[model samples]
Target chain A: MKFIIQRDRLVHSVQEVMKAVTSRTTIPILTGIKINTTTEGITLTGSDSDISIQSFIPAEEDGNEIVEVQTSGDIVLNARFFSEIVKKLPMDTVEIEVQTNFQTIIRSGKAEFNLNGLDPEEYPHLPIIEEANLFKLPTDLLKTLIRQTVFAVSTSETRPILTGVNLKVENDELTCIATDSHRLAMRTANIESKINGTYSVVIPGKSLNELSKILDDTNELIEIVITENQVLFKAKNLLFFSRLLEGNYPDTSRLIPTDSKTDVIVKTKELLQAIDRASLLAKENRNNVVKLLTHDGGVIEVSSNTPEVGKVVEEIVAEAIEGEELKISFSAKFVMDALKALEGTDIKISFTGAMRPFVICPLHDDRMLQLILPVRTY
Target chain B: MKFIIQRDRLVHSVQEVMKAVTSRTTIPILTGIKINTTTEGITLTGSDSDISIQSFIPAEEDGNEIVEVQTSGDIVLNARFFSEIVKKLPMDTVEIEVQTNFQTIIRSGKAEFNLNGLDPEEYPHLPIIEEANLFKLPTDLLKTLIRQTVFAVSTSETRPILTGVNLKVENDELTCIATDSHRLAMRTANIESKINGTYSVVIPGKSLNELSKILDDTNELIEIVITENQVLFKAKNLLFFSRLLEGNYPDTSRLIPTDSKTDVIVKTKELLQAIDRASLLAKENRNNVVKLLTHDGGVIEVSSNTPEVGKVVEEIVAEAIEGEELKISFSAKFVMDALKALEGTDIKISFTGAMRPFVICPLHDDRMLQLILPVRTY
Candidate 1:
């Protein structure tokens, strides 16, 4: 393969594909990025066992030449070194030439690099998915849905199913839920779908995390294709493929409380910062527990005590307090993470007794909710 | 002890003292920072076994009240926790009160912290240094001198003495030199000293690095006091004391050759970037070696080859080339570091032979020189 491409264009696509290249992969070809040149454009592919990413750069876009192809062929180059070389090159254009034995020569400005390349035939092919089950959604909305729920996924390997986020679509409504047994986060959004079918799948939170970084807040639409064991997300000239977990996700809707003994509406930033300060001393303990107590006159106290370290007490004025007074203890990090994911000036928190789970959501917004199981403090 | 101090002032002093605080220390008191309140001001001190730093915040500075002293006393609190608490406090001014039995209470806004403190008597006392060999230099100059030579200090523990920068004062001239036996960096500056004596000492490179960070580029004079076993640097309200390494420093003056077989002058930035790109492939090997070949027509070729990986070659234009043509190989990182240290637009390189050491200095400045040993490629 012989092609001369714009340095900036090649660098951007290389970085996007490199996200799926894992250094610890058992398959040697998985560690290398596959490069192919055609008459129309150049394609770069990188994959691990769990996820794969492919990006294409067209020869010409918007009346500007992006790539000049001399020949069409394919080769696999070391992803680590190839990206580094392109990033540090001085010229505005880079020329890549592949020989009969897969010897790649890359030249830019006065600098030239001869890299050893592997045969492209050894690289595995990407699995093909049918477009019949594809649905369209805005990239911004998908990114928001992932950010609001992905952090609550279980990080432990004991339960592999809990490591994924359960995504469900029904009646033109899409919902995403993630839980780690101790806490749960759920977000629901309306979709303008014409199809009359329900789809449910569990995607590993790791894949969504990387996908969110690659996506921008543009109003462009992204097509999501789903099958029994694989899912594909296509946007612009990029394709993202991830494997679906092989198990049923736990039903966490029943864990959320319906009634509460006390409810309070407070400024979100104030409450988040107070809990953050309280966690300074609480972090010495394994649970990182912080207690919240509601008092008269709409005052909320956040406190934590570690015997060997110290104790911290913070008071925040709530906008309104109703029902009975209550005290509850929960992980400070979990509460802070939930508050950060929520977007509103004021947040409403409901406590369903000291030992039961409590729910918090943006004030007057029922589309998102976070539930946490309170720890019993003797 | 009871006092109210501005948050900005407290944070600044805490960061200054934190430079001397090491996380792993055999002495428990060394891990804590001592706080002392007097009628005139407030003092904060932190120390490890090798160095100690103390900062004082006066009651008023520049006609602005910085500290309000309600009571006078001393106590030592864990450096790690105190810095965190002060950083997160919301109020502009923080109030600290010490109760009986070494209990400390810190209050800012509606946030309160109760921390356990140790007796101040257990903290080590700062050693007194006589002003017999006192001199003064601009803070900016000292910082520059440290930056130009400190990177050559040996990081390995094989030779403890080589891990320090040798400082010498003779005949109103101050000279600093550092080397790891492979490369040496030397900087010299004239000082208007009142003392007619000579002094030479080796200060730990780690201590100098921290000192450089804390010292700003202000033209204020820094008072340096030298003793048999310790050196004290006093600047304004801050006092920094470091222990001297006990060993004889090697004589590196003989290593710098006076004559050269080949000489080349080139732009510093161009040469640095070329070597940086050459190192991309050279780094695959253990030595990170890059070869430089000076050819006719003032063209310098920088190249590196790794058998299993690939090869890279770069050409840089030289302003002038004279004497015999030379080809020599050296570590890319070492050459780049030396280039970054020297302050000039152009640099002159003098090569003795293929196997001998070479010297590089700024084109117009003779105040600093860097010598690097060439590698054998046969």
Candidate 2:
């Protein structure tokens, strides 16, 4: 097998696929990046049992020749070494060929690297995904969806189902929800990728996180297909496949409260900063809990106290405060994450009481809501 | 203690001293920063018994008020907490005051932090050095001296004395040497800091590294005062003190070769890159050994081979080749480090034999020399 390729394009594709490669894979062949070249292009694939990423570079892109003097062949090189070699090549173009005993030779300028490669026949085959029921979402919106809700997914294995984000499509709307029992993030958007029927799936949060890193924030559509055990996301020149977690996601609809005894509207930036400062000392607690108290006249005081460490108090003016004056304690990290995810200047926070869960949303839109269960403090 | 200081100035000073503070201190008070205020300014000190750093923010600088409404007092606050608080203060001016029981109130804008402070009297005192003799070197020059030799220090604790950089003054010159037995780096300069007599000391490689980070790259003179057990570096508003290593540094003068069988002149950058590529496969071996051989036509070949992994070969054209043909193997890491430290486009490398130690120096200068003993290959 022999091919001469542009070093930069090869380096970029290798890096993108490398995000899904795990060095800890017990299966030796899984540690390698399978390289296959056809008349159309070269495809580099890296995967573990749970996630796989494949990137392609065409022989000719927009009349520009990217790869030349190529013969169709297949070989797998150790991802780590291959990535480093392509990045440090001395020239703009690199030449790679395979000799006897599956030995691969990579030549560029005056440097030549001979790698003991693995047989492509020994590599695992990517599941053939059918071209039916293609559900699509714009790249930027999908990334935003992942970023806004992925952080709330459970990192604990006690409930493996909670470790995945739940996606539901119904009534021409797409809803994405992530919860770790203590906090929940829910976002609903009008589907830009019109579909035929309603569907639901649970995708591992870890997979979505890795996929988010490789995806560009563009309006280009990403087609997704889900089978019994696997889900695939297809973008231009790239394919991402992830294993779906087994088990049902817990119902979180009843977890969010519908009414509140106290509702406060405050500047998102001011409240976020105040909570951040108040939580500085509370960080030792790990839960990072802080208290928010509504006072007379439109003032809110945020504070946290760790007996042996110290205490912090931050005050911010509220645009309006109504209903009962109250105090509640919850994880400062949860509130801060929710605040950062909201793009609006002002947010409306509703608290039923000190112990009950509270809800926060943008004043101008209700497309997303974040809920956090208050921590019990004596 | 009470002072209203410019937030930026306080932040910078705190960051500088915090580098010397370690959280694993057995003495609880050492984890806190000792803050002392007088009519002149406020001094912040942090230490871990071995290294101490003190930064002072004067009451005024360049006719601008950096600190005001200050009262004389002393207190110690946890370095980690204090550093984080000062960095995130909401306003340009932060107010810090000491109340009863050493309780400290730090207020900026609408944020207030109450820190559980300790008595400054309990903090460890830095060693006292009699101000009898002082030697000075430009800040940038001292940093260069450090960068040129410190990387060769032995990281192994088996030979404790080899873990330091030896600094000696004699015959109107200052010489710095560091070696890990396998390799030695020697640098010398005409005494810019005029002295009456010769002096010698061994400074811990770790200490010099930390000090290098805290120092600015300006040419302002820094005063160095060495006592029996301590060395102090004093700048305009900063003081750094590091304890002297207990044992004498190893003598490496006899290790450098005085004569050579073959000499080759090559572009420093080209040689460095060739070794870098050749070493990519050698990195897994940890020792990272690479071999170089001279060819018939002013050409040098750099290569590395790992039994089961891979191998790389690179060739570079040399400017000159003289005396004899030779092939030598050495740690690629040592050669790369020496090449990076030398500031010359063309370097003359001398090889005494395949098995003997070789020396490298810039063709036009002799202020510094690097020697590396070749490794045995089966």
Candidate 3:
């Protein structure tokens, strides 16, 4: 493969594909990014066993020559070192040439790097998904959905399916849910779809996070294609593909309570600060538990006590309070996560009792909700 | 201690002192910060046996009240938790009151933290240094001197003294040297001292690093006091004390080469970039060895080869060259560190031979010098 490309364009494409390059050396070819030159343009692909990313540099962009290909061939080079060299190269244009023996030479300005390239045929090919089941969503909305639910996914690998965020779609509405049994986060958004379809899939939270990082917050629409075992996200000239988890996602609908005996509405910032202060003391305890007590008339108190770290208590004025007064204890980390996922200025929390689970949702929106199970504090 | 201190002032003092607080709980009291309130001001001190930092929040600043002292007393609170609370408190002023039985109540706005304070008598006392043997240096200069040599200190505690930077003062010049046996860095500056006596002391690199971070880039003069077994740095109302390592530091003067068979002058930036590029491939090898070949004319060739990672060769045009042509290989990390410590745009390198030691110094100054031994490559 031989090509002369603009340094900025090559660097940008290399960075996008480099994200999927495997750090592990079990599959040596997986650590390299495959570069393919053709009459159309040049494509760079990087992949591990779980996910793959491909970025295409068109021959021309905005009437400026981006890629000039002398021959069409393929070679795989080390992803990390190549990306670093391109970033540090002190020139506006770079020349890349691959020999018959797979010796890749990259030159920009006075700096030239000769990297031992692997046969592109040895690198795993990205699974192709038919475009029949594709749907479009705004990049900003997709990023927001990922951020709100991804943090709540189970980090432990005990239940492999729980490590992914469950995506459910019906009609034109998309809902994402993530939970670790201790706490849960859910977000729902409306998107423009070509047809009414009901589908469910679990995409690894880590893969979604990486994909979100690569997707800029532009008005551009991302086309998503779902196959039996893999899902593809295509935006602009970038294609991100991830394999779906092969286990059944646990049913979480019954875990969310349908009713509550007490409800309290408080300012998000005030509650966040109070919980934060209480967490300072709670962090010293084994369970990291923080207690919340709601009294008559819109008064809420957050407190935590540790024998070695002492105690902390803070009062927050609630917007409104209804039903019976109650007290409950839960993990400060779980509560903080639930509070962060909330979007509105004021949040309404519903409690069934001290021993049961409680629901946290925006003051007026019911589409997004978080549930946290209270710990039995003696 | 009973006082109402401005939240910002209290937070700033807490942050400075907390740097010395021990993260390990082996010494319980060392993990706590001692707060003392008197008619003059409020003092916060934290110590971890090796290092101590004390920051005083005066009762008033610039004719404005900063702390209101209602009672004179002292208490020790958990440093980490207290600092976190103070930083997140949503109040302009914080009220602190010590109750009977070592119970302390800290209130700011609606947030109240009741911490279990320890008896002030249990806290370690700061060493009192005599003013007879003292010197004054600009804060910025002191920070710069520390940064230039600290990175070369040995991290292994096998030789306790090698983990510290050796400070030697003779006549009006103050020189600091640090070496891990493989490489050495030395920096010298002129300072004003009250006494003409020669002084040598080894200060722990960790403590100096923390002290450097707290010292701002200002023209303020910092007072240095050398006691029997401790060194104290006083800047304004802040006192930083570090215990001296109880051993003799090895002499590194003989390691620096006096004369050379080859001498070369090159732009610091150009050489740095060449070393960086060569290091990319060299890093894949265990030793991270990069070779530099100097020709008769002023041309220097940088190269590195890793069987699995390919090879890199780059040429840098040197300003001047002398002596026979030679090739030498050394750790890329050492060269990078020396380059980073250098201040001038142009650098002068003197090489004894291909197998001998070399010295790198700024082109127009002798205030700082770095020496590295060549590595044998087969």
TM-score of each: 0.98, 0.98, 0.97
Residue pairs clashing in model 2 are: none
Q: After superposing candidate 2 on the true structure, give the runs of residues whose Cα lies further than 4 Å from its correct spot.
A: none
lDDT of each: 0.93, 0.91, 0.89
Please provide, for model 3 over A1-378, each residue's C-alpha lDDT reduced to its tens digit, 9 standing for 90 to 100: 789999988899999998887687689888888999997889999888788999999998889788999989999888888888888776799999998689999887777888888988888777867888788889998998899899999999999899999998787888999998888999998877764477799999989999988999987889888888899999999999999998788899999999999999999889988998899888867668999998776899999998866898888889998998899999988888889878989999999999989999999999889999999995
Give the Å error, residue A33, model 2. Answer: 0.6
How would you class the docking of model 1? high
lDDT of 3: 0.89
Among these predictions, the greatest lDDT belongs to 1
In model 3, the clashing pairs are none
- Clashing residue pairs, backbone N/CA/C < 3 A, model 1: none
TM-score ranking from best to worst?
Answer: 1, 2, 3
TM-score of chain B for predicted candidate 3: 0.98
Candidate 1 on B119-159: residue-level lDDT in tens? 99999999988887788888999999999999999999799
Candidate 2 lDDT by residue in tens digits, A169-190: 8876889999999989989877
Candidate 3 wrong stretches, greater than 4 Å: none
The CAPRI category of model 2 is high
User: iRMS of candidate 1, one decimal?
Assistant: 0.9
